[model samples]
Target: MAGSFFRVACQDCENEQVVFGKAASEVNCAVCGTTIARPTGGDAEFTGSVVETVEAR
Candidate 1:
């Protein structure tokens, strides 16, 4: 198996992110600088909405 990718969102900042490879202690919101929790995985792919609406990419 490759790995699982997790989609993270900051409720306050409305910043969405994709995290992989290593789990992080604090994920900063690029737009608003809010910290989020990142999970563990690696080499993941993005989808339509997750890339469009959420992730900003």
Candidate 2:
């Protein structure tokens, strides 16, 4: 799949942030310092709530 952006909300703190779909590293929540997403071979594995997907323009 092509790389995109995702809006994820932290389940612990309800903090929202945008992350790369194909992130090469682990993504954490900025407010609560919780693990939000993990990098895989393709799309990032999300541990938080997926709010929406951002379309590339």
Model 2, which residues run further than 4 Å from truth?
Answer: none
For candidate 2, the 10 contiguous residues with the lowest summed lDDT are 48-57
For 3-34, candidate 1 gives per-residue lDDT tens digits of: 34556666675567765424444456677776
lDDT of 2 by residue, 1-57 (tens): 567888999999999999998888999999989999998878789999989987653
Clashing pairs in 2: none
Q: lDDT, candidate 1, residue 41?
A: 51
Give the candidate number with the greatest TM-score: 2
Q: Which portions of model 1 miss their true places by more than 4 Å?
A: 1-3, 38-57
How far in Å is the alpha carbon of 42 misplaced in model 2?
Answer: 1.3
**What's the lDDT for all of these models?**
0.48, 0.90
Per-candidate TM vs. native? 0.46, 0.88
Residue clash pairs of candidate 1:
21-41
Supply candidate 2's per-residue lDDT for 4: 81
